[model samples]
Target: MPVVTVASLKGIYPPIATPFADDGTLDDNKMISNIKRWSSATRLSGIVCQGSNGEYVLLSTDERVHQVKIVREHMPAQWQLIVGTEAGSTAATIDMTKRVAAVGADAALVLTPSCYKSRMSDEAIISHYTSIADASPIPVILYNMPANTGVDLSVAAICHLARHKNIIGLKDSSGNVVKMATVRKKTDKNEFSLLAGSAGFLLPALSIGAVGGVCALANIAPQLCCDIQEAFDTGDFHTAMAHQHRAVEINTAVTSQFGVPGLKYAMDMLGLHGGPCRAPLVRLTDDEKRKLDAILRDSQVQHTERIHDR
Candidate 1:
């Protein structure tokens, strides 16, 4: 395992989807195999386990911890391991945070508690994160995923949490880059960091000071995601824009258009293990799978061209 440090977090990370056997059992062998492949691929700062893409809400606490354990054991010793540990209640969140830290997580990505959405005011939001950050053994990264959680972290609340020493950064999945830029302007850059939650806007986010991203698209195209960051960092905006535009359709397919099952299918197409999602989250239909196949084939053609250009 790598030594956990906030400074080492400035690059791309794939919020990997969990792999389940056909009968719906956890596939440990597949999980280990995927992490090893991802670590050796191209340029990833780390891996995020049990994120929304990982189906964390559907998993048992023990299973979630097991996911982190497998990742820690197989991932490169130089790669950081970030684990998602959000729960419905504050006490549950704090308890899970400690459990993952005991295993090997460099940081915990805590989503806003939205079970009581009406009551999750700015004050309540601040109090929730404050309690967790105060108790967590590792640093905390606030996760603002409005699409899934319904509770979005206000800039005021995020800026307030930035004052806490234990809270290190945020993964804003809202796709509102303007708000993200506003948060960047308001918060202390050294004490706090910002991460794009999706690859759709990753290039734009980095342009406005986001450190990197935790893209679901990276599961199938890790090197593609790295190319976008590398192009931007080296001041090649024209190439970066081209890469971002070409990625949008495929990124949309695996994200809002099809969700996790679509992303898993994409992974399987690339010779990785993405067997099936758990119950309640079904697999794609035969027709939908074909559509995804067509999308991939087309994307690959464009991606190959970019590789040559670079």
Candidate 2:
């Protein structure tokens, strides 16, 4: 009954951060608050939960399903909700995907299986995705974040899967501009799309022909991300470049230099409720905080003034 069409899944969608309580538990209160904030903040085509930035690797299967349900229950009706359904094993991933789809997630994002990285040749990886895609109740978005997953979904593998009627698009977090370009150029452009996985690569990906992005950086600066895409669409390259640079600097700090704590701090500073990250992941040190603050200030993304309010 749910629509699995490609048109509905294309655009800037942030795999949003899961805000936790000070005690490091899943803060439903803060999570719901972020959902409300994002729905009104930017031109987000949709919302993605439990992806790498959301700490999907750390959560239990039950926790992932619950988060998906809560996000779906609270998110705006017009926005498509995509859940990160990747698991350590194919059977487990497929099982989790079914539960999430039933809870109203419009799509399931499955990253390449990584535990057996050496053994996973292109053939094995294809078997994994094809089997899950064949059984998933909802549409599938292949997530290619090599930094975290180690296993890269090469352009050829992506092109091969694009022919499947239910595999919609790819979120390439590999940070390799050429890989994104390759997927964009070689895939069935009509049936599939390339979503820049990292905000740092959004402009480069777009210049080479990507449809949109699913950025961790969007967790902090949503409007700028939207504006970059808008600028390109409307023939405003200068503004797009300006926004693109700002996004790159901010993403570098929050995602690469500072990681989760820096992101949570920036989110809190920007009026979004980015509470503590879960256990095992500590907050930023004082020196790190000072540097992160400086980065945000330089990029003009840390001020109380909302880019949207302007």
Candidate 3:
């Protein structure tokens, strides 16, 4: 049985970066420290351990499970814990989902299987999510990351899956507000939660009824991200727009432009344990680091300590 049941998925949740040591092994100490720091720094709704920002595709099955266990053990009970359990096959996805559920994750964020993109039709996509959700011990949140997965879950298919008893919500990273609004209109507002997968257009999505965001920007600037949602929730659109504009620049830098390496570097700059990305995802160049530093400074992301010796 799943240990946590996420009744409401409204608020900011950071798709946390996986910290690796210089030797390329998981740095448990650093990861725990990062979790501790994030918990204290902001009031996030939850923490996503193996989402895209976490470099989920790079980790082995066992490593993914271990990451969730570590996060579950340390995270505050008030915060929901969601783990990315996406796999290439439905059977594999279900297995991973169950594994994470056993370790205490409240829900599984399963990405669309795009290994055979040509065959991932509407019927195929619906079946994939339906089967996984049917078997998952915990509720499943559909992950639509067309940038990485290549296959986008159409609004029609999403509306269909929204009816599933076990499938609860979506994390749409496509940045298509039109499609998001359409899906929002077609689904049951009470039963389905729509989460923007990027902070780039979080306020717009929220304006169109998105519950919150699961953003890479939140990894370094969690309070800022949360503030956007908080301000909007309280009808302060002016304040939310101000935060949203700043978030777009920073979000683009860490996500679409520089990817995981840039995000880890940004985390390091903010005095968290960002360490290194796994193999193949190299460290940022000096020029890239300088650019990222300027962006963070400009965005006013708080840092308890300086990136360099002060």
lDDT of 1 by residue, 164-198 (tens): 99998999999999999999999878889999999
* Backbone clashes (count) for model 2: 0
What is the C-alpha lDDT profile of model 3 across 1-310, one tens digit per residue? 2243334877899999998887887888999999888877677888888998898889999899898999999888888998899988999999999998898889999999999999999999999999999998898999998999899999889999999988889999999999999999998877888999999999999999899999999888887888899999999999999988878888899999899999988888777888788877889999999998898887766542232113
TM-scores of the candidates in the order shown = 0.96, 0.96, 0.95
Clashing pairs in 2: none
Worst 10 residues of 3 by lDDT: 301-310
Q: Which ten residues in a row have the lowest lDDT in candidate 1?
A: 301-310
Given candidate 1, what's the lDDT at residue 45?
A: 89
The positional error of residue 89 in candidate 3, measured at the CA in angstroms, is: 0.5
CA displacement after TM-score superposition, residue 143 of candidate 3 (Å): 0.7
- Candidates in order have lDDT scores of 0.88, 0.83, 0.88
lDDT of 2 at 8: 65
Cα lDDT, model 2, residue 95: 95
lDDT of model 2 at position 55: 85
